[model samples]
Target: MDIFIKIIYAAISILVATLYGLILIGIVHKIYARVHRRIGPPVWQPILDIIQTHGRKVATSHGIMFFLGPVFRMAGGMGTYLFMPVIFGSVVFSNYSMAGDLLLVMYFIFFGQLGMALGAGEGGHPYSPLGIARGLSQMSTFELPFSLAVISIAIQYQTLNITTIVAAQQGGMLNWTLFTNPLAVIAAMISLLGMNMHSPFSLVLAPQEIPIGPPIEMNGSFLGILQTNRALFASAKLVLFMNLFFGGATNLPIMMLKTFSIYMFSVFIGAAFPRFRPEQSFRFFLRIPTLIGILSVIVIAYL
Candidate 1:
């Protein structure tokens, strides 16, 4: 009975996170449209898209791996969200937390993308492999600064448990990692621009370069699953970043506010800048952001 209740809570947590993510994406679209002086679809457009896509019949089939790709991607998004506590003190919403959860969360982030890559390879589309190559290489490059920043915080908190880290930030804004270790936050937030795959660093879905990259052949439910994961994965990344750098939220509204604000960082940058060439994007992360990440770690360890 107890386990059953926990399962229910987990399901609710997932639903709430998914809705929040979808809404956030819609809001960004609206914002982007407004920035260009055009009316945009309502904020509920993304939710409608998911429903519409799911209703489509798959016209063709790939192999088992192709079938499993979206499933694995969804699993990766869920895995990323489930292990981290969503709120600071609310047991019903906090979800789960454990030692070394940070590392696991990072792995899940890459894991979902890789799953899609595998499925795309099976897609046999000539462009799928090309897109996969670009996406993977870009991901590997951005992960460098991100990994360093994560290490810096892991050292600052002296633990890999995300809950403990969030707990340490409670009581005031100053207690947040943002203030305590600004350098690490700086590094992480900059790397976030790449992780979110916004302009300049938008190499993976380089529609101009690779015709929107991987999942080019995905249709119907396969496309639906990938789309859904896009929201889930984006929200999971935002929540994790909030908990790590901005201090975890105590309630749903606060969580929404913080996460949305964090996401805006990328959106604004994306709009202001044009896309970079793949090589330029890779070089940018490896040079400045990587240096910042390293400096952050050194500051935390020695200074």
Candidate 2:
């Protein structure tokens, strides 16, 4: 009965996270409309887009693996949300806590990326080559400072459990992780900008450079699923980042607002800047964020 309860809880949590992500896509679409000075599609636009694309023709791949890729991506993302702490005193799947550290979570993120890369390769499209290369390169470049920033947070709190870290920030916003380690937050903020694939860091999918990057050849139903999942993943990332620094609030709307604020900032920056060359992105990631991460460690160590 205990195991069965856990299963049901996991399912409910995954559903909540996925739907929350979908709603966020709607929210972002509205934000984009405002930013671009045109009325964008409805908040439900992404969901509609995916539904319309369902069952349309697609480029066939090495059969089962190609079919499995998107499914796995969605599953992995859902799995990720399962482990993440949602509110004070609650995480859906407690067992995942045993292995859910900054390092483990990072690895899960990479695992999803690798799965997408392999699936793209199996599709045998010319653009897939470029997309995978660009994706991998971008991932490699930003990972250094991102890792360091996570390490700094772990050190400060003296624990790797994300739930504990967020719970510790109970008093007020100033006591939040962001104020406690500005440099680390800066590094994390920059890394998130890249990880979110926003403007200056959008070398991987620069329309002029690679045109949608890893998902270039994907189309129809498969592409639709991938697109929906992309938005879902993006929202989930924001939640994870917020939980890291802001602490989980009992109020859902407040949490949503905070997460969307960070997301909108990214989108605004994206609209304002041009894409970076891969090399330029790598350099920026390394030099500035690494400096911040290092400084954060120093501050945390003695202060």
Candidate 3:
């Protein structure tokens, strides 16, 4: 009975997260449109797009792996969301956070990417491979600084459990890791720009050159699954950042505001800058952010 109740709670949490994720994507599109001085789609545009994609009559698949790619992607996104404690101490919103720690969260976040890469290889499209190569290359580059920053925070808190980390920051805003360990925050936020795949780091999607890259061949229902994953994955990443650097929110409204603010960091940067070449993006992450991450580790060790 207890296990069944937990499962029910988990299901509800995922559903809510999915809805919130879609709304956030819609809001992001609206913001992007406003920046360009154009009328934007409705705030519910993402939901409509997903529905249309899912309703399409035909979809092409390239072997079993190609068919499974989007499935793996959705699983990855949902799994990541499930493991995160959404509203700090809320019982129903906790999801399955006890099943994993920060290390597992990091691994789960990359699980979908690896699955998608395999599926892309099976996609049998020349551009798909090219996009995969660029995406993987950039992923490797950014993961260094991001991982190091996470390690620094883990060391400082002496626990890989995200709940405990959030609990530690409860007293005041200054107690947040962002204020207490600015170096790690800086390193992480910089790497986050690449993770978000915004301008300057948007080489992976290179629509003009690669026609939207790895998922180029995916259409109809498959594309809809990928679209759904996009919403959940984006929200999960934002929640992870909020838990690590900003203090985790105690309620739904605060959570939305904090997550949106963190998301805007990438949006504003993407809007103002041009895209970077794959190699340029790689080298950029290796430079300043890497140095800051290393310094953060050293500072934590001394203290």
Candidate 4:
């Protein structure tokens, strides 16, 4: 019965994540339609894209590891969602939260990225050369500030558990860490934007320049897993961000609303700006928000 219950919850979590992906794709479709002055695919277009791609043939290389890459990447992401707390509710894997710290979570995020990078590089496509370069460059730019911001919060709460962090925000919006340290929030937001591969910071693909980045060489069922992985990881990252600062929702609608709101806000910002040059992105991360993150930590420590 315990195993059955966990399975049921896991399935529900997946369903919720799928619906969230559909919503994000739908919004992108609407935004593109408005921008190009033409009707776009239906809201369910991404769903169709996923299904159609799942059965297509893929070039086999790197033997088993090539296929294992997406599997491991997606599995890691899915396991992360199980361990990560949503709202005040305990997650199935929450019991192990004490075994690791926020730093562990941060490392796991890198693991997910590394998996994609390895798979992309191993695919033997010269086209992905620029993609790999951009990905590494982008990672260097974003990781510092992101790490500092997490450290700041971890220090403030004196614990690395996601649940405890959310609990700290219980008095209402003002008690939320965002209000306590707006600069940290800003820095973290900048980092999150970059991490999610969104614009301004989204130099990895640079639609006008680099194309789809590391995933450029991929197709078929492998691409399907990649798509699902991206969508699920994106949703999980958004939720993690919210819980980190704004606090997770006690209600489902509000939680979804928060997730969608963040995603849309990201899209709006992405649409508003052109891509940054590699050097420009590096400087922005190192000189600007990086300093802000440091200062926020200092300030929050005093308070």
Q: Is candidate 2 or candidate 3 better by TM-score?
A: 3
Count of clashes in candidate 2: 0
Cα lDDT, model 1, residue 223: 83
Off by over 4 Å in 1: 206-210
The better-scoring model by lDDT among 3 and 4 is: 3
- What is the Cα-based lDDT of residue 143 in candidate 1? 91
Give each model's whole-structure lDDT.
Answer: 0.89, 0.75, 0.89, 0.75
Give the better candidate number (2 or 3) by lDDT.
Answer: 3
Model 1 residue 228 lDDT score: 86
* Residue-by-residue lDDT tens digits, candidate 2, 114-157: 77887777777788878888788788778778888888888899
Model 3 ranges with Cα > 4 A deviation:
206-210
Clashing pairs in 3: none
TM-score of 1: 0.97
Poorest stretch of ten by lDDT in candidate 3? 203-212
Off by over 4 Å in 2: 57-59, 91-99, 206-210
1-303 per-residue lDDT for model 1 (tens digits): 977887788889988889888999899889888988999999999999999999998877889998888888899999999899998888777777653489999999899889988988888888899888888888999899989999999999998889999999999999999999998888889889988888878867854455777888888899888888888889989999999999999998999999999999999999888888888988988998899999999999998
